[model samples]
Target: MATATYQNGSLSAASLQGFVLVGFGGGAQAQALLFAVFLAMYVVSVLGNLTMIVLITRDARLHSPMYFFLKNLSFVDLCYSSVIAPNALANFLSSSKVISFEACATQFFFFSLLGTTEGFLLAVMAYDRFMAICSPLRYPVTMCPMVCAQLALGTYCGGCLNSIVQTSLTFQLPFCSSNRIDHFYCDVLPLLRLACSDTTLNELVMFGICGLIIVSTTLVVLISYGYIIVTILRMRSRSGRHKLFSTCGSHMTAVSLFYGTVFVMYAQPGAVASMEQGKVVSVFYTLVIPMLNPLIYSLRNKDVKDALKRLGQRHSLVRDGSQ
Candidate 1:
């Protein structure tokens, strides 16, 4: 872990002892209440995402490109949420909310990588849906298993590159002003405020990279859906149109929930100014959204429901035979 060093009456990020995350400060009662709420949420997030992963991986019926993407999405949700929730939950009950310099950097690195990767994956999913709906015959060949794996790999690579740049720029500066992070977790925006030196470059690069990721992916989703909608409209069968819309509906909802919060949090220029709002927004994206995704995908989809039913039936059969 990089220790803080003092030089010339200033403390560089390396010289910093650590940071105090003043997470949702109200009082003992408020902290306790929030602790309970967030703990429940974290448990739900873990269980729901795990169930999705288990179901997707075990069930033969969910072997298509869409579920393949959905499985990865669940895994990302599982991972990225774990990166934040456990840390935040621990802080809620502790008297000291201090996190070491290296620890903070690690949190930001994984969070950025996983979160950004999900954005790219979601866009990839949109393309998958577009191909499935608009060019059904070509869909299998184009989105072959090899191609899908490559696309998933590509998302992680893009996210890693983005994380490297953001983490490098944000942490290399002097954190002499204060060792206090105003939000729940160690995000780039909050950390940027603590830098004593000029962060013009950091802000610019963050805006540029984050903007490119969000905007480009969002455009992919929108354009894909536009084509998907047209194709659905032209379908002569009512049931076919309904099924197509249903298939895309879950992805669209997930995209909307995930992307909207991200755009406001990262891409919006004024985001850093409001720490209180940032905390709420951060909580939503980090905790609430992950918990919601599995429910959104599963409740609205017939295949997952049937898979769950089948899995339950098989378990029951095994139990009865053993008895």
Candidate 2:
């Protein structure tokens, strides 16, 4: 841990060379339990996301705009989950939860990049759904392969830019002495609190940027769903409406779970108790959501379920032939 030189009286006491993450502390037994739980969740999340990606690639039935987005989403979840879960699990097992400045900064950067990218990707997925439902005839033309590729690329570019600004702005602040970060990961708000310098401008800028991303993407999702609803209502076939609702419902559930926890953790006003609450909520969005996404999509979607079944039967036949 290389310490920052403090010149003048400007540097506050909270500045430090490295940070100690005092994660959800319970007794040793409790930490052990948490480690087991998180380890299990991590394994499951990776496997689940990988399975979805493989299914999407191998199954011709899933080769559509919607699955394209889903494949990307699964990839994001896999990478995002990897960013935090392994380190967190290690901290739970190790006595010292210390992270050097460079490592922490790197973690923060990737976390923000992937998370912001996923947000934009979800909005794009909603638009894909809207076009599919609201304009079935024109959907093929409107959401061509080129268009889908462009949308996906745009989300990645946007997320990278957002993260660069945020990570640079955050690490530019001086930390005087306080090396303790209360949260599990190197999140923005908790890191901001440790800054020795005035963080009003930083906070405001971060809030503005995050707010813009969240609000704009959310509006796109809402508008897409709004149009989708009107179109569904006008349809004569009940079964067709049911199918549309089913697809949208899975996406809506995912969006709600993700945005709901994120908003609670970052956007809302906090009480002293809210910090504790934020940790729990962060676990859900950061760890649990990634695991749940594949399950939600697979269970709700007939196409995925069918693909899984075919995959299983094919494997069984291969095994029997070897016998």
Candidate 3:
């Protein structure tokens, strides 16, 4: 157990004081409201992503490369939302918002892992679209079942490796400083700020790993889409261009929201916790993005709408027959 005590301008590492997690300094009313809001978000995220997964899995008509990647994306979104939302909701409801040191580290590890995996997944999806549009003749061969599976595996593995390195380095330094985390979750910067020991190594590692992943993934997605745009422009039929753009609209929106929020959060210099502002930004990526995923994809997708209609008609017919 790490004992926490304040000594002058710095924290004393000689005594190990256990840490507690205090989320958003607010009273009972605020906590209750916050809890309700997070609970609603968690429910929506779970239901939305799960519905997509089930629909994609059960619908034989959706047995294609596109839907397969969508199914994978939904699964990733569900897990990603679950990793942070429930714990956040718990902290919001409780007056004593304390998380064990081990648990906090675990949360960060899994969150980083899933986040990196999602980045890779999005990049891969962009390449899929590129092949489909830019080289239609090679699309089927390029995105074969085996190739898709390998890409998915690589994304997961890359995410896991990145998380391992980041989490290990972040926690290696002694957190002899005050255990008061300014944010809702155990993000790298917040946790790093509490170190009783030096964190130059941690910061470098954090910036390096995060930057490399974001830059590499963004570059790949951009290059793939660059070719895709050229190919779309070459098509003489306006309807064909529109159809192609529409198919990619949902993915593009999701990728923009995700990468945009992440970039704002982690990319800038001198970007520390700004109390209320930080929480709001965190909400965009952690809460709002997860909730919006299904809505963004399904609302714009004709197949999803058709499937829902079919499901509703079947239910209606079943009710009439039962009556």
lDDT of 2 by residue, 177-283 (tens): 66789988999888888787888887777777777888898999999999999999999999988988988999999999988776766554452255677788888
TM-score of 3: 0.92
Per-model TM-score versus the true fold: 0.97, 0.95, 0.92
Q: What is candidate 1's lDDT per residue for 8-63, written digit by digit as tens?
A: 65678766878988889788899899989999998999999999999989999999
Give each model's whole-structure lDDT. 0.90, 0.88, 0.82
Between prediction 2 and prediction 3, which has the larger TM-score?
2
Q: After superposing candidate 2, which stretches have Cα over 4 Å from the reference?
A: 1-4, 9-16, 269-273
Give the TM-score comparing model 2 with the true structure, all chains together.
Answer: 0.95
- Number of the predicted model whose TM-score against the real structure is largest: 1
What are the clashing pairs of model 2?
A: 13-176, 13-177, 14-176, 14-177, 14-178, 15-175, 15-176, 15-177
> Deviation in angstroms for 235 in model 2?
1.6
Return the candidate ranking by TM-score, descending: 1, 2, 3
Position 262, candidate 1: lDDT: 93
Clashes (N, CA, C under 3 Å) per candidate? 5, 8, 8
Better of 1 and 2 by lDDT: 1
- Candidate 3 segments exceeding 4 Å error: 1-18, 317-323
